[model samples]
Each structure stands twice: as C-alpha cells, then as structure tokens.
Target: LFLGLIILIAVWKLSQTFTIMNLGKETSESLGISYSLLEKLALFLVALTTSVTMITVGALPFLGVIVPNLVRKRYGDNLSQTKLMVALVGANLVLACDILSRVLIRPYELSVSLLLGIIGSLVFILLLWRGGQKDAV
Candidate 1:
C-alpha cells in the first residue's frame, strides 16, 4: 500500500513538473509562488490523494508511472494535456493487465503489482535503449 501510494505521488509530481516547467520558473516566481509553498501544496495533495486511494482500493496499479509516460509519449507534454493523457493511458493499462492476468492464470489470481513490475522492467529497457547514453544510475 505504501509503495502504491508513493507511485501515485510520483505520478502527480511528474505531471506537475511537466506543466510547471513550460510555465517557466520566472512566471511562477513572479506570481509570488514560493518554492516552499508550492512544494508543500504538491506534497499535501499527493499525500491526501494517495492515502484516500489506498484505503479505498488497496492501491491501484500502474497509475503512477505508466500513465504519465504514456501521456508524455503520445500527447504533447503540456501540463493539461499530459495529465489527461496519463490518466487515460493509466486506466487502460491497468485494465488490460488485469484482464491478461485473469486469463493467464484462470483459477489463480495475480497481483497487479507483480504484473506491473514485469511491464515496468520492459519499459525501463526500452527507455534505456531509446536514450542515446546512460546517465549515472
């Protein structure tokens, strides 16, 4: 649950970063948005969201990482655009994986996290391949 919560928060952060970056630091700063204030707002929101989600859903899968990446890739990485794209893609990915897992092990069930981990590994590999050079890990 904690892990899922973290990922949810991360997704929110990524979305915010992509949006805020385009707005430019200058504009944001000029608006009297202090770094500490923004940071606190973001942190509080993510935490509240994840905590509520965790209690209700026992942690949804693939929402944090997959949605944002899929959005960034398909749509322009603008704040509003990316957020929408990520939400849609994330939902689709989770649904598809859930279906696949059900079919793959008929009577048995698989954890969404486990399936996402496998998919995450593949995604990581693809990212590395597409990246011209590796950064310090």
Candidate 2:
C-alpha cells in the first residue's frame, strides 16, 4: 500500500526531479530545483518503500541496489520507467530465485533470502568488476 504510493510518487511527482538531478548538481540547482529538499524527499520515499517492503515481504538482499542498475543499464536513466521496471524485475527475480531454491536442493528448499544474498552478492561483485557505470550506486 505505502510502497505503491511511493512508487507512484517516484513515477509521477519525482520523475522530473530525478531527470533534473541526472543533469548534475549545478545544472539542477540552476534550473531552480531545490536539491536538498528533493534529495530529502527522495530519501524519505526510499526509506518508506524499503521499510514497507521489508515489513511485508521480508528482505531480499541487494535487490535495492541491483534492480535499479539493471534497469538503467538497459533503459537509461528515465526514473519513471526505471521505477516501474525495478518493481517488476524485482518481483520476477524473486520468483525465479524462489523456483531455483526449490529445485536446487531436490527434496529440500532453501529460503529465498539466502539464495538472493548469494546471487545478489555475486552479481554486485560482477557489476563492480565490470566498472563502467556512469551512475553512482
């Protein structure tokens, strides 16, 4: 519920803010966007999104950082599209990891978080090693 609202804000109210910020601090500020306020709002929205998600669905390690990078890597930095894509991709990635967890141990099933932690860590390391990211995580 709250996550959905924040997602909507990210997709709607804050999309222009993100686009402006993407232009870098000086340019965004010159354009009359209050960087600090928007930054605080973005951070608060992210915190609420994270808290709501963690409280409801439990944690999926590194999905926070990983999904956005993957989306941006493919779609560029359109935060509206990237925000929606991140939600969809995160859901799909979790489902895929859940399936893998159920199958990997045959008669046993691993918790999704554990599999996510392992997989997320490896992918993050790989991304860091690849190292051509124009955006800072």
Candidate 3:
C-alpha cells in the first residue's frame, strides 16, 4: 500500500540523512558528501512523505519534532537507534491520539490535528524548559 511504502522510505531515508547531517558540516564535506544536496534531498523526501501521510491519514504537525526528541532524550544520541525510535514513537503517538480522539467524545471524534497540536506544543515546551534549566545550572 502507498502508506506502508512511504513510511518505509521515510524511515530509511531519515536515518541515512540525519546520520550524515549530525556529523558536522566540515566532516560531512570532507567525507565527500555534498551537504546542500543531501539536505535538499532529505527535505524533499520528508515533504513528499508528509504530504502523502496527511492525505491518507490526517495532518499531525510536530509529530516529527516530538517523537524524535522524546526518543533521543530517553534513549541517548545513537543515530541508528534514533531512527527506529522515531518510527516507533511516531506511530504509537498517533495511535494514542487517535484513540483519545475517538473515546474522548463517544458520539463524535475530535480532529487529530487539534489533539496533536495541543499535546505536541506542551511536550515541546517541556523539552525546552528542561533544556533551559540544564543550561542555567
């Protein structure tokens, strides 16, 4: 199915792209990877997958930021681990939100975008707060 294909491609490409990106720019360049091209390619792939996902499922903005950061904070900064973490966390978070949407109003369902926006913003704020606290120490 189109959804499965996009999810697979997104995970694979995300891992490869972020691995290269996290390696500082000078290091990536020295290793013969064109930073700009790879960055552009990664962005394109992400955008394509995101658009497809939105079309099929529904829009859930900030899932990307929320999932990746939650995973990394709990599991550490291993790139390979982070990729899998992103996929798993993103899927689970969506599932949870969908369930909440359906159950919270028995006769009607809440739009996923609304729930994700609220939850994602809170999580992002908490993450920022934690980071700021660490820096202030």
Best lDDT among the predictions, by candidate number: 2
The C-alpha TM-scores of every prediction are 0.70, 0.85, 0.82
Per-candidate clashes come to: 0, 0, 0
**Tens-digit lDDT string for candidate 2 (13-62):** 77867888888878989999988888888888777777878788898899
Error of 3 at 65 (Å): 1.4
| Alpha-carbon runs more than 4 Å astray in model 1 | 1-18, 21-24, 60-62, 132-137
lDDT of 3 by residue, 18-101 (tens): 786778789889878888887887777778777787787777878988888788778877677677768878888988988999
lDDT of 1 by residue, 1-137 (tens): 66666766675666655366447667767655565566676777678777877776666654675556556655756765566566677778778878877878889988876787688677766765665464311
lDDT of 2 at 125: 83
On lDDT, the stronger of 1 and 2 is: 2
Residue pairs with colliding backbones in model 3 are none
Q: TM-score winner among the candidates?
A: 2
Roughly what TM-score does model 2 have, to 2 decimal places?
A: 0.85
Clashing pairs for predicted structure model 1, backbone only: none
User: What order do you get sorting by TM-score, best first?
Assistant: 2, 3, 1
> What's the true lDDT of residue 131 in model 3?
83
